[model samples]
Target: MKRLGVLLISLSVIACQSEKKTTGQTDSTNAGTTSSSLTYKYDSLQVFSKTTTAIDKGKADTAYAKIVYPIFSNEQLNQLVEKKAIDAAGDVDSEKPKTYKEMAASFVEGFDSVNGEPDMGQPGAWFLDDQTKVLVSQPDYLCLEHSNVSYAGGAHPNSAMVFWNFDPKTLKEITLESLIKEGGLPELNAIAEKIFRKNEKLSPTASLKDSYFFEKDTFSLNRNFTITKEGLKFLYNPYEIKAYAYGSTELLIPFSELKALAKPNTLLSPTP
Candidate 1:
């Protein structure tokens, strides 16, 4: 990675939002499950904001980024929700992953380093801005999506997406096993493969080896999944299954497909 010069700046803001699932009738039986009609509200925390800039003669390049995350308002009940996000963001894969605030600072502080001449007479400049979105905000369950875009003197900038799911009542991060039965992996993979083949316009009998996927001969389901009224949607980030040129792969497995494999009394139940 080429280094670019950087400078730092800070900004602050307070925002609040609430989401209530009122489309369906209240179901007392699904109180602990996502099917329950419960309202969820959260407080926002913005930290580690900065702007970095590089200069060459009269021209200058700059980059700015910040991390804005959520904190559940129902502190006593949703403590786990907050803890899980903080831990995951801090534990990101890196030689030394930093906390949410620390990561934001690092991103701006080290936007890019400049040690060489400007490329093609264009002053080196880059910018990245990241934000979080609450996908599912219910009393029992919560899902969040983090999106980021970065540019660093290259052919093109890149963007990445990450998702997080939590069970507020149990204070635990939702996993693949938690949503589907142990025997369901095979079935899920089968469904995903069919969809993938269809999306890629490959013949049913065509072999995956003909594709550009990293594991051309193997079919695998991305671990990142989000809950919804329709079903679970799996997200495969760039390079997760195929080359970045092919972009991300999304697979939506309707609740009906996993009805038999869904755990008992969970959000996987069909919404009425």
Candidate 2:
């Protein structure tokens, strides 16, 4: 189980950098001066291995990992992205992997080492498929989505999806608190709960205690949200607010509903 944890963490780190094509273009105008726009590209890393044993005469245990992440022109932004990816992947020890390639290698090596143990019982081949993509690329915000499916000798494979938002100009993470006005969270949550009920087709006054996992039968907004052209999109992954069998739930709160709660000059603010 410990090795399984390591494999999960390492694979997630490697999954942050997969290959994708992107181009940078400059807009021209009648004026002599030019304004440059920010752009990014992507690269990928992969590692795989299998273990050999003399027991069953050809059933080898295998491990594989793949990762894709974006590369920005700005070095500061690049470093920040790398740091965030590593952090989100989960820490192992003081001497953790420093790059995506190393992370992939670590995952493969960990699985192979565990398989080589003399008394270890054969479970099955293990694999990790991870992908990270630019979900939304706008002038003010950049949203990244990381998703992965993995099996580590558990009862069943697991899948997860995560989103990260960043401020392009400042290279800072765009937190929900940063976009909302002070004392506006209550109103925002109320609006979001209403929409959530509508999306789930639940009556407005329905009790959540029986069917949902809210702490006190009250709905609340989570930080796992992304900014989209249509609205603020939130994702509740499997087992997050419901049983794993229920899968994920998506809630999109329109920008119009959040206009009063949004702070001025932020991405959610309406243009004049």
How many collisions per candidate?
8, 8
lDDT of 1 by residue, 70-100 (tens): 4443555444444444444433324332244
After best superposition, candidate 2 residue 260: deviation in angstroms? 1.4
Q: Model 1: residues >4 Å from true position, as ranges? A: 1-58, 74-98, 112-124, 214-216
Candidate 1 clash pair list: 3-113, 3-114, 4-112, 4-113, 4-114, 5-114, 7-52, 7-53
Q: Which of the numbered candidates is closest to the native, going by highest TM-score?
A: 2
Please give the TM-score that candidate 2 achieves against the real structure.
Answer: 0.80
| Pairs with backbone N, CA or C atoms under 3 Å apart (clashes), candidate 2 | 15-67, 16-68, 17-67, 17-68, 17-69, 18-67, 18-68, 18-69
Give all candidates' CA lDDT scores: 0.58, 0.73
Q: Which consecutive 10 residues in model 2 have the weakest lDDT in total?
A: 27-36
Model number with the top lDDT: 2
Off by over 4 Å in 2: 1-36, 52-59, 91-94, 116-122
How many clashes show up in model 1?
A: 8
